[model samples]
Target: MWRAIFRKKLFIAIMTAQFMIFAFDTTTRADDVSIGFLYTIPTLMGFLIIERGLQITIVVLSITLILTGCFFPVPIETDLLVFFANRVLSIITVLITGIMVNYRVRMEQTLGDALAKERKASAMQRAFVSMVSHEFRTPLTIIDGEAYRMGKVKQAVSPEDLQTRVKSIRQAVSRMIVLIERILYTSRAFDNKISMHLERVNLWTLLKSIGRQHSEVALSHQIKVNVHDLPVSIRADRNLVTYILDNLIGNAIKYSPEGSVVEVTGQTNGTMAVIAVRDQGIGIPEADLPNLFEPYYRGGNVAGISGSGVGLYLVETFVRMHGGRILVESVEGQGSVFTVQMPVAGAEPAPAVSTGESSFPDKQ
Candidate 1:
């Protein structure tokens, strides 16, 4: 044990200095160099205890200090108070530094946790989109094959029967393709995966079809869908615009209770397309409106509602990408309204419309 202490740098220096201290007038404890010899070994011991460098270090230092400093006396003044004071100071320093280091380590761990969550969310989005590709590719391949086979059969089959079967097959395949694309787009948008590609599209024609498609739903709901402008085209991605409309119109239908009003109105005011989807259903609470676009965030009245909470988020992202904005208005039990403003190609807010809205559709 004594040998191990002698081998340590602190202990060796202590021994060397002890020899030097005695070489001079050995009675002075306050001589800085002498006090250094007086203080060194105990400080090392304090560090050992606090750093858990003991059981290993103290076993040796314990025996050595007792022997050299107390057991075998050097005919000099050894003040007990000074020795203890130095040890206490060293221990305090070790404890405080240790605590701070631990705190920093904990903070780093927390940061890592947040980063991990974000990464997991991103991976889930990618996986969801990837599945869309795989699933759609298979159905699309079958559709292509069926269409090709039926085309060949056209040469042999009667034309009347052929037309009906072909039309059904084509329509069904088209719907599937559109659904798949919507899923991909919507997922990416909600996942915060945004990089838009902007292009020019006739605003009037786009809203006209969107209005016409939902015409039956509007009539049933007793809602009127109006296209404010007839032939004005806007600079934006047509696919993304379609997705935004789908969510709005679809949501209107979902919550409309079979005979409510839904209005689809649009206009190119100055340099943007102003589109609004208004419906009469169970209105959203004023408090819940803030989090409407948050993923999985549903309102109080929507407790049993069949929605994934990705709609408004996708809408917001798409609108922003087009360097545009969205606004909502609602009163409890009256209904809700959502308006989207998208920038023109060369107008203010040069941002483009990011595609991939069909990312998270109503999961069936």
Candidate 2:
């Protein structure tokens, strides 16, 4: 803030000095003595103004002042030719100075932008490392705890208790597998190496399958699917579509309170297929809506939740890859509805690139 105030003051001072120079050249100078070149001082100072429009205005103003100064009185013995040449040279000097200043400003802006991106990438890398460490540790700790408990039991454990312990361990392992796959998919998406195997897929069947998978794991949350108006089939990459829905449904379950209903609805809008996942979760904050899909950006409200923050990023990326768009609506405490719309006939096939990974994993 202080820097901005100083810059504004400096700009005003420069403009004041510029006008004083023009006054001196037009009113106080003898005709033969050409000090029109002094206008270049203000033109050089224009580097302080980052706006291109303002820079161009300053250049034009300097040239105008130089030309106007030419009309003032001169000494009776002055050589008209020399005076005319001097004025032209002064104009050229100001123009060149303005050009150089503008070029320098542009270079500085570009360099600044590049540096900012590098800083943001570095910050995100640190966040990714921290998030992965925490996410992995939770499940590992759970698995270890279960094992330790079973081993310490002195009496014969009941079959039901043994089965329950095994289920807990398997769930922990499954959570780890999902985390690893999400990271892999995020990397592949960033590299633009995900290849689409486009085929005709039944929308209703796909939603039902994904709903079932999430339902089994998130037994506390009820999953509902309504697809009566949805297009029967869409030509798309089945696996990518599955990932998109899976992430959306999974997130809805993860963020919402226990026993909340997560409704998956679909409809047809002209040639586009529209699907929406509505969750009675802690809705996102208004400030986070715009950047919700940025990689590794979690909502400020989800402090204790276990998430790598790449789910929505990948969802949006995959949706766009299939030439679809996603939209979201939410209130702070009510809920969020994520809507996705895509052409029934999928996008043109992307150029095949080897991602060096197998197809999306099957549910365990």
Candidate 3:
């Protein structure tokens, strides 16, 4: 804010000085010379103005002022040819200076933008490395711990205990596989290498399958699916669609408290198929909403939650590939609802969905 105020003050000062020079040039007559050339000073100074349009306007105004000075009161002894020639020369000088200044400013802006992007990429790379290290270490530790426990047991292990240890090892390995797949998916998404094997898929059947799978893993959370209004079938990439749903549902379960409800609702809107995953979870902070889908960006409030932060990014990417969009609404400490809208197969593109007020009710 202070910088903006300073810029405004500087702009006013430059314009004021330019006008004063114009007034002096118009009022004074010096033999056969033109003082209009002094306008170049202000035209060059226009570099300080951040806006290219305003800078160009300054140049044009300077030319106009120089030309106007020619018709202003001057000595009768002043030669017309010399006066007109000098004014034209002054216009050319100011115009050239303005162009150079504008060009320089543009180059500076481009360089600044490039630098900003570089910085962001660097930061993301560091975060990705750190996250990968931590994510891999957790599963590896679990697998190692289970192995060490079985090896150190002095007595014969019971069948049930052996099964539990084996399950733990498998779960750890499965988690590692998931992490690998997510990383691979993100890479493919960035390279635009993800190919969709479009096929007619049973949407309702897929939802039930996903719900049952999540229910097995998150036994404490009640997973509910309502697809009464949803289209039974749609042409889509089954794998990508599954990825989208899996991520949303998994996140809903993972982020919410044990015993909380995770609801998956589906419906149709015009030419669109809408799916929403709502959860009674530790709601996202309002400030984090805008960056929620940015890769490696986790919510500020999810301190102890285990996450790689790529789930929502992949979700959004897959949805876009299917010609859909995702909308999210959350109130801190209440819950969140993520709505996915996709174009129905064999239909014209659906109209854009407005994310008006959130449907998630405020907690009493």
Q: Judged by lDDT, which candidate is best?
A: 2
Tens digits of per-residue lDDT for model 2, 1-364: 9999898768866775774575456333535344555554664665456466665665567556656666766656767766666656665665677677677878988999999999999999998899899999999998999989998999999999999999999989989998999899888877877777677889999999899888887899999998888999998878889889988998899889999999999999988999999999999999999999999999989989889899999999889988899999999788999999988998765565323443666556
**What's the number of clashes in each of the models?**
11, 1, 0
- Residue 163, candidate 3: Cα error in Å is 0.5
Clashes of 1: 11
Q: Model 3 clash pairs? A: none
lDDT of 1 at 337: 86
Q: What is the TM-score (0 to 1) of candidate 3?
A: 0.82
Q: How do the predictions measure up, each by TM-score? A: 0.50, 0.81, 0.82
- Candidate 1's error at 249, in angstroms? 2.2
lDDT for 324 in candidate 2 is 90
- Tens digits of lDDT, candidate 3, 141-193: 99999989988999999999999989889989988888888888787777766
Off by over 4 Å in 3: 1-77, 346-364
Query: How would the candidate models be sorted by TM-score, starting from the highest?
Result: 3, 2, 1
Off by over 4 Å in 1: 1-109, 112-182, 190-197, 229-231, 267-270, 303-305, 346-364
Candidate 2 achieves a global lDDT of 0.82
